[model samples]
Target: MSVAGVGGFGLGRPRARRTAERASRKVARNVGVPLLSIVLLLAVWQGIVVFFHVAPYIAPRPRAAILAVTQNWSTLWPLVLGTIRETVYGFVIGAALGLSLGVIMAKVPVLQRLVYPVLVLSQAVPIIALAAPLVLILGFSVTPKVVIVAWIVFFPVTVNVLDGLSHVDQDLLNLARVYGAPRWRTFLQIEIPATATPLFSGLKIGATYAVTGAIIGELAASDGSSLALYQEHANSNLNTAAVYGTTMLMTAIGISWFLLVVGAEVYATPWQRRTVARRTWRRAGGESDG
Candidate 1:
């Protein structure tokens, strides 16, 4: 077969392949740019501390931070574990509750009217302001941490999910009803699938908020109980490097968790991938035509 034989099926096969190669290059560029930026920033930070001869007590450098984290591994290990446990607990509980409430709010107009305003108002109230009360009511245990994480996470997921549900296509709903599909069936088949994009957005937002919630709750209840306690202690002792290290650790953990959820979203919503791919192909074909 000659090269022209392949053209019978599709003239733009070469064009499509070129487009895909360009897209892959774009993806690499996107990832590499940020990774390079971070690496550069760290290098600059390390250089500054070394050049300035910064005292470890006053302001420990990156090396000092790494050393502090490693040297105090015995003490930091337990605190890190506690924080992780609390964060995961809060994230899970909050996400579950928020998802349930969001589905209900979408289905029930009365509940939507009744609950949404209150939820919005709650967001206006600072989580820190109630941190003390949360501790007082829930005690200086894991309960408060989990509660705070859930509280922070619940709002974003609820709002996103509710919005997703509301924005579902009316035609789909009508079709479901015409077919005599049960409410649950319609919800699972039409509503949930429709809401996948927004739900994933909520999950990503909630996952990150989980860290903030855990830290706040831990700080409030800090009495040798959690990671925030140690972070606070390190800060108070002017162990700036340790503080920085722990904060970096938290950031890494949060980013990892969020990425995992995003990966799950991509995996579960293969339809979304197909839709995007189709659009991309169309766009590329049009561009090539032009």
Candidate 2:
């Protein structure tokens, strides 16, 4: 028996164990780093409040804000859900309109010229001012909130889609044409795939905007909105804990939306991960060689 044959199974066992260990470490880092960052932030916040002897009305300690969230979970949970519903409504409508409009403009140059300026002009107006009028016209209901969110979402997505369409690999498309592929096939196979990355980039941008739009809409509505409570706590009751807690919740919503879009991108573009890994491996090997 050869020496290599004798130790093949032993070598395989160690290789499999090392692979498992690496995966476990990656999972731990993903979860642990975020937790560590949050702990450090809260510790710093608590320290600042203590060191300055900050008044409760001006700024409460981190513990106070956490207690506010826990104690008011029943009331706050429903409000959070409502906010999420408004966000979803806005995102869906905005994304649909953006994709449709992007395709139309790409196909028809005259319409693109006529419509592009209007879209640009619409974004110029202050969103806060725009929200009030929408509330006045649409009334203090979910309609105004949905409109606000949708309007904010539409512009970014359209721009990204347009940019992506412009950058499709023309040489590849010409090659497909030479091979007798139909225009529809080339578009579906080449154009859409080219645009997926930028489309998701737009979605991520819109995700953050959607959160802000919902909150802005809520302030205008004056109904069961979290920001309303924040204003009341700050201006009337001088309750810093409630104010800080509300801000934290709002931040969480925005982060959640961004992460949700990121997850979609990861799932939709698996090849992107492989491409990134390949580049990293090449760079590492070059450094080692140097």
Model 2 residue runs over 4 Å out of place are 1-18, 224-235, 275-290
Cα miss at 108, model 1 (Å)?
A: 1.1
| Model 1: per-residue Cα lDDT at residue 285 | 44
Residue by residue across 1-290, what tens digits does model 2's lDDT show? Answer: 45767655655432223366877898789878988999999999999999999998888999998788778889888888878888989998998888888878887889999999999998898888998789779887788888889999988889999989988888998999999999999889999889999899888899989989988888877555555555465557777798888888888888898888889997778677543334534555465552
- Give the per-residue lDDT of model 1 (tens digit) for 1-290: 36767647754533233368877998789788889987898899888878989777766777777787889889878877887888889988988988999999988999899999999898898999979998889888889889988888888999999999999989989999999999899988889888889888998999987888888988887767567777788899887988888887788778877878888997877766453454533554465552
Model 1 residue 138 lDDT? 81
Model 2 error, position 225 (Å): 5.2
In model 2, state the lDDT of residue 282. 51
For candidate 2, report its TM-score. Answer: 0.83
Q: Top TM-score: which candidate number?
A: 2
